[model samples]
Target: MVLGAVVLWELLAAFLERTMDESVYEYLDFVDATDSRIPRRSTRAPGLAKALSLLRGDGRALLFAGTVFLVGAAGSAGHNFLLWQLQDQGSSGLLMGLWVGLGPLAELALHPLRGQLLRALPGCGLELLSLAVLAAQLLSYSLLRAPWAALPVQALSGLSSGALRWRLQGTVGDVATPGSERALLALLGGLCAAGAGLGGLGGGFVLQRFGLALLLQASCAGLGLWILFVLIVRSRLPRRRKINYSRLLAAESSEMSDSEEENEDWLVKAMRDESFNRNWIQQHGIK
Candidate 1:
């Protein structure tokens, strides 16, 4: 199945490359603000130095990293033990497969509404929603004695994980300095990796010492902490004036069409125009 998926992805990528050359080039041009054909960091600094700068200078980036680390740790500790929990209840392979498969299906079902949700909710609201859903699922799993009881609960993971990732990516993008996105992403990835690794290693010992029920409860507590962190961070963010999302979308679409007709990308133009970027930040309330 994995191999087939890989093959399908390759085919689709090749087809897009072949048939949508101009559109692909336009997107590439938009992302490649430097137009050097190389996506180098604007600062041209070493990775370690850039990371240190973010830690020392960018409070929002630091807060984002800390929040993601806690999320990774809680996710790893709780999720890795889920299969074991089912097995302890004598779940069969078919039941386990159903439990796992339904999650991705639920996540896929939510994709069509993803843009609308993002437009409606603040970034912090999405994170809080993700945490709340995860906490509820963990609580349910902790209370369940029958394997079948846990099957429907698995879908919450799909929803929570999807929302969390979507909000996280947007938060990172908003906080990252122009042309420094790659470096910041690399750094965030490293922190999350470390957190996950530590969580997995520590979780086994915790399960042995505290048992499954306690471990699941602890996971819920961790998620609660994450919710608090998000709230605190949100409080610090600048307040955005209310704007009509539908109107904003229309204006952006019109701007895109006008820019395309002028042989320019809106983003590239924004990168060149200080006032444009400033107005954008002010309008969007991007701190």
Candidate 2:
């Protein structure tokens, strides 16, 4: 039923795309404008070598990539062991499914308050706190023998994994170069996949030999060490400047005449100019 629903959803999406007017997709204007401004000589997709060089040039991006890898590994290890731990505690398949579903439900519940949470906590600070929460969740999983007792710990996924994803995307956007944003994000995805694979392999090995308790305990300890390392390293690095996007957009909109606003060429030019200004500001390290 789930697979059929997914297939039907895809068909509906395809139909909508074919039937919808191009003008209705407003975000496409940004993509078109960006492409229009690119030099004919440099219109090719970003090469892997260029992307790697870009990553290497940005200190914050490098740090973020390393942090993402570690977090991914720890998160994957915990997830892979969760069912096994529950099964050992004599949890039925239905109960185990509920345990798995609760995390995403908690994440969904957090969506409404995400903006307020982001406003209340700085990005890096929120990320660190999320890591701490994740550590706690792992510790709970390690120690709790009662399947029901461990169910509450899954709710921590909202503040931990969910928040981490939000922070990671925002941080990537902040650090990435104008044209290199996609490449950097793709790199982030690659790191996540690699980390998860390694985590699953190593976790399974330990779980098979030493047991789930030992694996979860070790994951918790390693994550704790990573959190400390990130704290120290992040403190020594320069703080990321938050872009006032609302202000930038308002200023741009105010400067445009009504006739210019109506012109698609003018709109595209304005977006291109905004992109150029952002690139300049990032490159120059202007406060």
Top-scoring candidate (lDDT): 2
Q: Look at candidate 1 and give me any clashing residue pairs.
A: none
lDDT of 1 at 189: 80
lDDT of each: 0.77, 0.80
Residue 194's C-alpha lDDT in candidate 1? 87
Q: Model 2: per-residue lDDT, tens digit, 1-287? A: 99999999999998887567344433454575576986544555544665687778867667678877877888887788788778878889888888889999999999898888888886577788788998899888888878888778998899998988888778767766565665677788889889889999998899899988888889889988988888788779886677999999988877785557679777899999999999999999997
How much is the lDDT of residue 58 in candidate 1?
56
- Return the TM-score for candidate 1, rounded to 2 decimals: 0.67
Superposition error at 281 for model 1 (Å): 60
Evaluate residue 120 in candidate 1 and report its C-alpha lDDT on the 0 to 100 scale: 84
| Cα-based TM-score, every candidate | 0.67, 0.71
